[model samples]
Target: MTTPSGPTVPFALARFATDAGSVPGLVVGDRIRPLSPAELGAPSLNEFLAAGEAAWDRIAALAAVASDASHSDGTTADAAWRPLEAVTLLAPVEPRQVLQTGANYRTHVIDLVAAGRAKDDPRPIEELREWAAELMDRRAREGIPYFFIGLPACVVGAEEVLELPDYSEQHDWELELAVVIGSPAFRVSREDAMAHVAGYTIVNDITTRDLVFRQDMKDIGTDWYRAKNAPGFLPTGPFLVPARHIADPGDLRLTLTLNGETMQDATTGDLLFDIPALIAAASETMPLLPGDLLLTGSPAGNGIAHGRLLRDGDVMVGTIEGLGSQVVRAAAARVPA
Candidate 1:
């Protein structure tokens, strides 16, 4: 029912539910212990993250105590520490706002540009790739990232089933490294953006490829609301590793496998605009509150690029280095018999 840990020594934070209710918890190795809100003086993870870098240190102190209290030698910890497998893990954070980036990966955008070429154009795929790569390089040097807003209502835990909307059959998977905001950021510069990050997590940004473009209004661009806001479309987190535990967010590896086949395998470094730029750009127009998610964009190897879309009973397992991993399955909605 539940799962939980991380890269450096394997420790992290997450929300879990039991028969009593739900609580935020610290996971060390294969065991977990709750961090009561009253004790931390913060009602939820949003408040806790709003506490800024201090919250991480406070959680560190809690981890020490939890580890001490959880000694296996039959103590009151019998109820305090539970095996990681016995709990139900929820989406690590309940973000008020989710800023999603599009085509921010260098190679990814090149792949997309090459994929969308007109059939009449006689350029070879390799040559087209080269031209697109040059264009992406130019954009990286002189461009801001393409961003879209996402609904938090779509957030769901990794274990949840994905009911593919029958309205479109071109659903795709895009696993990415999600930055968890700590302090409120408004118009912050790129140099100062990293300070506002509380931690990191994995998000599978599932999309309906065909619904992305506006069919009715041909002039209008992508319609993210209809294309991306399906229930359980954003499958997030098995754990939220504190920023302190991650050496470098830009260098982390992101991987997603579908039904045992590798779909996306890339590193955050492939992003045309890195995490700091994303945070700075996203926060420039609006305030990014604590617990908000800033997605750093997805890499290449998407269904649109591959032409192989999701089907009923397809399973996806997404992982990010240092943060954690998530497992999700797609199930088509059934009609009444």
Candidate 2:
């Protein structure tokens, strides 16, 4: 119900995770200080997000000061706040529901179908486009929007392990730009959608392609969370760059690295649905809360299309130009056989 305010924050910002050791960080006045657990005092980003706009503004102000001082002389002070590593990167917002879109990117759709990763179902595409156009128009008039959900437990932060489950051999990685809701939004208009966004982060919507398509064909209930929620399946975050800091979400660069090789690279402009549409579609179902996260679909070059599955010890990295990035490692799940 609260009107969203601008971030009023700058880049070169990050919330330190208290649980991660070695809190050493670059201080406000261009000084690098080793942070002991006691010296590190900021709550987790998830906590700060829950604190609402007033607290967000304060946090933004402090980050802005530090960001400004870091680049005081035109030299970029690029230091990763160790504290971010300590906290388990929860979903940007703790939304009661999480919604993701399908075929939101043209290339993602075309490439998947061409590679036999997705079915050549023109009917679904036609329905979705019409649905999207209608939703877009509806959002222009009213404040309510449509959106979807991802499983809550399907989230993991930077440097975390993505354990590929033993049930399937079709694990895939999707590089997506995730939007975190800052304020309460219900039936929110597109003009107001961005206002409700607190910031942006990176998400790897890891999935089991074979399982998903097979389930989709049966007309049964969705198997999305089941295939996507394997332990450590959702690798997110190294930082959450407040929305104000980003000049334009559409203009940002998105890239993903598997092991040391770069696999996917694109931008938000390539999104078929875009952020505003996704927001509108989502708000139609439920009120997007402070911590709700909306993941814009990924770009071309997924592992599935190329037949490359992750192995133990593979490192995965995802980055969005202004929003910082995340690094996740992969390994076999440790289960008692």
Candidate 3:
């Protein structure tokens, strides 16, 4: 196996549905080199990822070969490679465990706090923002990332639609950068965290605003189990860009548009707790197995902050720099006739 020629020659990992079954592939430009059972030892990314970083290194090397061959003579003798457009793109990884860091973005938390202020409050927007900024700084200095578990069943590929549950009109969108874990992590230090990461992908954590908190149990706090666990709620991936390709995860830009209008425009620089911090903190209590996901929180500019929740027929297009784009359509859950 050969290593990637250089970081400039980009490569992504993806999954596609074939007549035989689901197949994981190496993405080079517009073409794909599908993996065989002998290549990765499994048909699923989750299982293959369990083989760990060496497996990933081998794949990257193969991608480099494919990348060079694709540009060199315009044709390769290997029949395994196919056009990306000819296949259906599935979620890049089948995470055995999915954990999300909540309110990790400095500005997003501040915006939510400011927006929640009562209309009768005498404080001006400038004062509120200053106070929020200080609060965020304090959190970053003294606090660790807040994490919550998510059901894997809620995950769906980019080809799926976001079926807005009829139970709540307060449906909202939160586009985020997701970490795909490779090496096992257990009580690892912050400095060693990145070594465990396999790559990154995009996930839109849809929520039912009304179901986020229980009316009768105010002291018990947020009900994330109900608020964020809807089927098709977590629409993920056109592809997964291995960590080697991303120059710096913290320097990437995130953009999401609702029905062709920009709703979220921010950068990873706004994150209060970086990826390493999140991984280190989360793995402290539990063993993070291969192919598990750790989602960095969303940046500012969600539906509730703008008072413009998702609606039927609304198309949500989310893109994170170098991670590819996701186009998810929201619609009212149809009742059976």
Candidate 4:
């Protein structure tokens, strides 16, 4: 299951079942190679990532040797290679921190603002469009990216079922590209931001639409914590494709389908602030640790823009070019009396 040049193999780290229980594995073509305790040195992908670049280099080297040996012996089948379908895919990594960007996609922001104005404004349609365009242009030049912290405890594997909170009726889906930090980063420049990235993964940034704004305090604006950080709110991964495998993160296409219908589809090219900008912006005040996740915002066609909020029994399928896809099913909340 290993590749001749392990570094070139583009491994997707995951956790799958073992006689002893679940263990971290490196996903190769149609099989997974379990990591030994000596190789892993830790139980989770989070620790593996924090072990530094040298640890990853060693993994790649070992994989390359295994691959070479397998090919040379003419016995490519090894017991270590387990069927991919038989294994359970856990969240690729347990992030130390989760950072998410808001209103970072050009079309998504414009659509939201325009939709709000259409509901209550008396301005002409064309005038409203003109104003929105102008506003975006000025904001791009003068504004910085808006970021919010998310609770890592809310993260779940892609295959896990989503449980809706009883208090919110308007649960929504936001498909975004998530960046996994490879090294410690603080006050990093945009020019050198890409180097700090270890890999890319998929994240469905689910939101409670009704709770986004505090009705009790209008001036307080958005309440991201309450609205976005619920258990199973963030369904992430199926794979974490190495950054080296992704030539350009900004050019990847992202698509999301809800119950067999394509709801959100867009490319990363539409991002108002690209990956480098987001990394630089996020690292300005806080240090980004290995395995930390930074979500680069969602594109247009979210439920908020289309009036098609998620409901119980809804199934969401999110896909990002190069990284992989994630399917999450939603269920009604089981509230206790």
Candidate number of the best TM-score: 1
lDDT of 3 by residue, 235-316 (tens): 8886877787788999999999988899999999999999889989999999998888899999999998999999999988
Local distance difference test scores for all models: 0.84, 0.62, 0.83, 0.81
**Quick one: RMSD of model 3?**
4.4
lDDT of 2: 0.62
Report how far residue 122 has shifted in candidate 3, in Å: 4.0
Q: Estimate each model's TM-score.
A: 0.93, 0.73, 0.92, 0.89
Worst 10 residues of 3 by lDDT: 1-10
Deviation of model 1 at 35, angstroms: 1.8
- For 1-337, candidate 2 gives per-residue lDDT tens digits of 1111112224323333345542323223222223333322344434445555575566545556556655446344544433332344433334445567666665656666556523555556556555555554454455432234577667655556677777777788898888887667798877877878777777888987767744436767446656676766667654556676677887778788887688998877766666877787788777878767787777888998678977777777777786555777777778831
Q: Of the pair 1 and 4, which is ahead by TM-score? A: 1
Residue-pair clashes per prediction, in order, are: 1, 27, 0, 0
Scanning candidate 1 in windows of ten residues, the lowest lDDT window is 1-10
Tens digit of lDDT per residue, candidate 1, span 138-177?
9899988888999999988877888888888899999988
RMSD of each: 2.5, 7.8, 4.4, 4.2
As for lDDT, the candidate ahead, 2 or 4, is 4
Clashing pairs in 4: none
Prediction 1 TM-score vs. true? 0.93
